[model samples]
Target: MRVIEVEHFEAWRAAARELLRDGVPAGDVDFCSPSTQKSLFGDESDDGGRALAAREAAARQRRGGVTVPPDFLKRARMVACHRDEHRWNLLYRVLWRLTTAEPNLLHVAFDDDVRRFDLMAKSVGRDAHKAQAFVRFRRIETEDGEQFVAWHRPDHRILRLVGPFFSRRFKSMRWTILTPDESASWDGAALTYGPGAPASAAPSADDLDEMWRSYYRSIFNPARIKLAMMRREMPVRYWAALPETQIIPEILAEAPARVAAMLKYGASGTRAVSAAEFLPEARDLESLARAAAGCRGCELCERATQTVFGRGPSTARLVLVGEQPGDQEDRHGEPFIGPAGEVLNHALVTAGLARDEVYLTNAVKHFHWEPRGKQRLHKKPPSRAISACRPWLEAEMTAVAPRVLVCLGVTAAQAVLGRDTRALKTRGVPFASEWCERTIITWHPAASLRARTDEERRRIARELAEHLRVAACA
Candidate 1:
């Protein structure tokens, strides 16, 4: 057994090459006696590579003739926690050293970063750049004319672990795994691996690269997107294989513009369907509500228990909009049938408008609520949700074509007015929005029911009746 220590990588490489060529498996070589470059090869012409090559030759000459003793395996673990290129090299050097023998006495000292790296590396294998650089394979032509090749890289090299994965996933195609240190290719049948070629040109796959570039461009989600996180998730080394790497600079440069575009996009409702095509001047509220129940325009249908359709007179001139269905409304499968509806009914009677004469509905045609105890409590919908639900309200408005709309609460006010309505500040004010004409903000009857004081209830109820009167005459 003998050990040869040399500085030049080619020295070790030449030795391994000769042993492999001579049918000597690396494991069979005994390293009981180690040879340093200064001693075994003498001056060695000061070329470390030449010294290693000579030692390998000498070892082969004595292999069957000399009694070789196994070298004791010495083990040491990487202790540094911080991530640095130098630190990475140190870790790999130790790792590769241990691969030559079964490890013994491998000591590990802890660092937070080292611990994190260990955890991450355990499941995913080593950093692809290090550990597996020397992998090479030979190209073989199959009897059926299919070309394929296979080779073994360093045991724990990142490419070796991931290369097979890429091969299996990207099966049915030929690909090259080019590391700076070495390269391997599996055409279809046999695998070829060897020392890395000169860094002349990056191995190219024009078709796949272009497809990857296009996909990256297409799937750049503007909503809730983060650039730094993306870069962290996909490091730069991977970009050499991916087509979109070249376009990343442009994408980052235009990020501000993209963000501005998203903000400008805001919560505008979907493009309006032409009233001329759908309305035809004669569609009734029932047809419209039934049509709205089948809407797939947004995800509101998936979250809400049921679509709470509008219920009221077909020819009513006055329209009322509530925020959404309450618990009772949700259970009953009707709009405005909850305690809020009872309060609204009393206000309607005081205002001299019969419940049967005016059409009542919700801004959102669904009960958006979350479960609490046994009750499904109402949850405020996001701006996007509100925007999504606006179409149904518009459809109802378009069909019923009410002369005046009464926005019963903040959500209703937002849906109709396209802005927040402070109910206390603007309860009696009338304004027009993109969806409706002669729209008035009013205290929702539910507000009256929730009031703690009789005086507060009286104030809200009086305001609600006043708005009803305004709708009746308008």
Candidate 2:
């Protein structure tokens, strides 16, 4: 009826199996035994001792000399192991907490090691915590030269399995992984880490570490911060490994700066040239589109997949304006190549306008959309974002000097006409605006496609084409 405590579930289970093999009757064994007070944990009042002793007596009375269930015994064995009498039992206690099912049984088990169990309590899962804790190493200048090293005692002997990944990741450097039970190292010669040393050294930094940190800071999406999810994926313990963890507080305190920092890092803005220096010699629409791909003019570009630029003849007399790029345009990085473009093309030819006769463009260059699973559905840009992009569109018009302007949708109308007007209400009529001499507001072909009927789409397309013809001569 003796109780055995080992550090890990595997060790405890091994001891239990050894006891079973030695011909000990299951009824003679009592797993819920009180832990003796020890100096390491400081002041054990034996709070759970009586409960375990009582449960032990009852189990004996119910099934005296009965064999324990293999499944139940296996699980019990895992929970019974202990490493030391520390303020907390890092290994076995965590196993007990994970394997415990019934309250009565858990209550009895807790009596033996309540403080140890409490140390393992966390809202985050144990594996994630281990991933954080076990990922270790720091650079130390020792007599043996600068060697990358790490040391941490893991609950499991998983280093053999997961150690190789770190080895391959940091192959160029010499590193040592030290655990309570074993150690491993890749010192440009052989993998040497197994039970021996309790402490290990630190890793020297590679030149790319800063670059990696900067890149990490930049790509971190502020909009997707779900505190619960972030905590789940990255427990508090792992923050030490992440260099950008320093900015996490800053991220919470001032998210915009973090986001801007990230964008600038992603752009590697060191290569950025002044606007006057970067403009193309020819200054055509295609060249402008390519240039806009590097634009960080507004925050909308931050979420967009890529910059979508207007396409078509640069020398065309008429210029057609549409809303910001839609989903297809965002992915393809070319404007007016989507369904709306298809319908508009048919109308353009039907109205006696060659595809090359007009400069096809969008009011805003970047795609704005809400991601739904694999699809990025269109999100109408804010009026401010539209206004912010007006200069680029104006630059295109100023460079090409088109005869007439066609506002393809409400967003486009707002940009060119400086007033928001419904395409349905203003279609087929020419209006005067300060930006363009004569502009016609009409349904963007995308709106017609969403109407879901061919006849309605064709009708809107016909009206759009008719307005284009009128603008061609204007």
Candidate 3:
């Protein structure tokens, strides 16, 4: 067996990719790490060789083409975050099967390999949650400005995996989160990773500690305390670093008295459901339209004047989904009636398709916009909005039951195809999606309108018409 060892996820990915490219069977390779038996190879798995392997693997990834489902690679990346002794080997075995004999292997939930992979990924996901939840940052004064710092020791090598979360949550501020295995720091502009740090590197207290402790004490509901559940979610290992945990003993001792005092007051938990939950029992196009007008699924509904539903014959076989409504569509409560609509109309004529012969809709019925002077300029909907409005889109698809589904932009494609798909790179190619037999994605008419030059606009318009023609023929 050829010996290969990896210290991290990227290293394993690189080496596994190289091995796969060489058409090496999974059984012919031995994947281990320093904590395991790297020395058993008598220095063959040394630093120099591992470094070279990582470089080559990166080059291969850049060259593209890994045929496993997008979800497989996503899960594999998460699984690699785990420090399990056999994850590397298991990943390679599953990948080999996915590429060769069992292309639909991930669909088999009870299969041993898939189950193990799912379990490992779940553990990594939990570790990621712990890292995101429990790491408490203490404020410190620096020469540049105030910088927040925190220290944590995650159960897995999840520092790299969860760094992006910290960056997004604290985009405007500078902060540093230190762990035993790695450290991540976010300047106001960018996020950077450095070497591991000692717990002593983090400050034990900050000026806001007292306020934070006070707030924690105020919110601590002894009546709702479940020691077992709390310990499981907020593990004891993390308690030493959490300042609020220092007062838990005192709080627990006063539970009975607090419960008695709380009996004098009352709190209740009841909430209204969103408009999607208000779907009529009949579950048809007319009902969906009426229900969507009051959709409180997301904040976008608060501003959009009305929910713009699809327009076409129910018997239409070819359905087109756009990103969202433009200014004109939002005002008129229609799918396509703006400059983009004109472009789509022109493309339809060029491709020999009639507007009434096909269903026209959008991924999001609500228009998300920003103020640009006197006009409401269209903005890309948030991922949360995309997710919130997805059920409505699916309901439309079910009601229409179109034989052919066409996505007109990246956002719409992401909603229809799995969110992780590289929609741009492979536009005009047919995909098999749950909604239809032949799913095709192409340039949005809005994108063509935004082209910088006339030549580019013409080229994109031609491309859009060609894709429409392909969809019609399909």
Candidate 4:
């Protein structure tokens, strides 16, 4: 047996090439680190001399170079970063097979050696990603200036892979990230490496940490808590170094009571008046629309350009409720005048119904959006926002008293029907609502506009027209 000691990936590749050139089979070679001992089987008399001669000849030869698939080299490099001591041997064995036996060995999914290498590489990659996401930097005072320091514990040697990500994100700051196996430091202009460090070398707490924990606690939405998903995304193993984790237990303990309180009172718990409180007790449709213009029942009214109320004949038999107004609709103070409205008008004409024959409004009257550069991008309103605006929608339903109420999307369907009703599952099905005799669920015109392909858009438009035809018949 021939024992080859290699310290790193490049060293292993050089040694493996020499051994392969010398015609030394994998079974006769014992690849290991410099500190490991040789196998009990011992080396042959001429093996060392032959390997030395082959190494010298390879250093002199400049003809054909070692060739392997690009993916194999990538996997080999990632596997080399693993903590497994046998990783070198495994990679060299696979390299030998790729060069001599099977050129396509790495492509075989069921191959034991390929599967092992893939698992090791995947583990190392995952460790790298986790390290990038979970590292928290703390401010520290030093002789030169203030420097940020962070300490992390990763399962693999991934300091090199995750270092660039931190450098790109915090390029203006001087920081050092220390792990048990390695350390990386960025000095504002460049990144430098150092030896490993202990957890005590990092600061335990700082003044900013308390503020960070407070922000974390404030943003924890009790209504949308999903314990399984939270644990899956941010595992408990990484909670030790995160300052926000100090309050996770407290947040979780109070979540149930907070959600109950939100349900008992309003979502914000400050608004006690019903939708009727926002209105001026006017029974006429125009008076109700004017009253809705000054509504502060929800936070959306604060950001919207103006309140978009329903338009069309109040004597119409069909009332259509949409999710909310769009950017153009919010500016123009009308629903169904934007691109989505164009699609709805076309579908209504195709379904043999005139636009003036139906009253049009929305479940939520205001436009909800987040600013993107100079434009306002539409944002989906949360359930609380919908609930706050439901009173206005209920008033519209009471005033119109249409023979057929058509809900255009999930938000509108949930507003008219119960919250548990799903629009996709209830489409084309007529259901009874408290405000109307018959209510039909259908795809919103915006859904057809968002379709991925022409074929999909045509299909959605056809389905929407069919539902509208049913509503027209009613």
Cα-based TM-score, every candidate: 0.40, 0.42, 0.53, 0.51
Q: Write the per-residue lDDT of candidate 4 for residues 1-474, one digit (tens) a residue.
A: 988776557667767777777777778888777585343222436685467557656754832566899889887888887989899889988988998879999988799998999999999987876786688899999999999999999988788777876886687789999998778999988987777789999999998798668656644667777789678657898898999998988999999998797667665667633455677667667887767776767767657766888987778899999999999888656798788998999999988998877899998888999999978988987777788778777777778889999999888888778788887877988878787778899999999989999999999999999999998887
Clashes in model 4: which pairs? none
Residue 373, candidate 2: how far off, in angstroms? 2.2
Best-fitting candidate, measured by TM-score?
A: 3
* Lowest summed lDDT window (length 10), candidate 1: 72-81
Clashes of each: 23, 20, 0, 0
Question: Which one wins by lDDT: 1 or 2?
Answer: 2
* Per-residue lDDT of candidate 1, residues 38-140 (tens digit): 3322454677546566777786675553211122111111212122323333333333333434243133436443344455444233344222222222233
Which parts of model 2 have CA positions greater than 4 angstroms off? 1-260, 263-287, 420-425, 452-455
- What TM-score does prediction 2 earn? 0.42
lDDT by candidate, in order shown: 0.57, 0.60, 0.82, 0.82
Rank list by TM-score: 3, 4, 2, 1
Q: Which stretches of candidate 3 lie over 4 Å from their true place?
A: 34-65, 266-474
Q: Give the Å shift of residue 465 in candidate 3.
A: 22
TM-score of 1: 0.40
RMSD of 2: 20.6
Candidates sorted on lDDT, descending: 3, 4, 2, 1
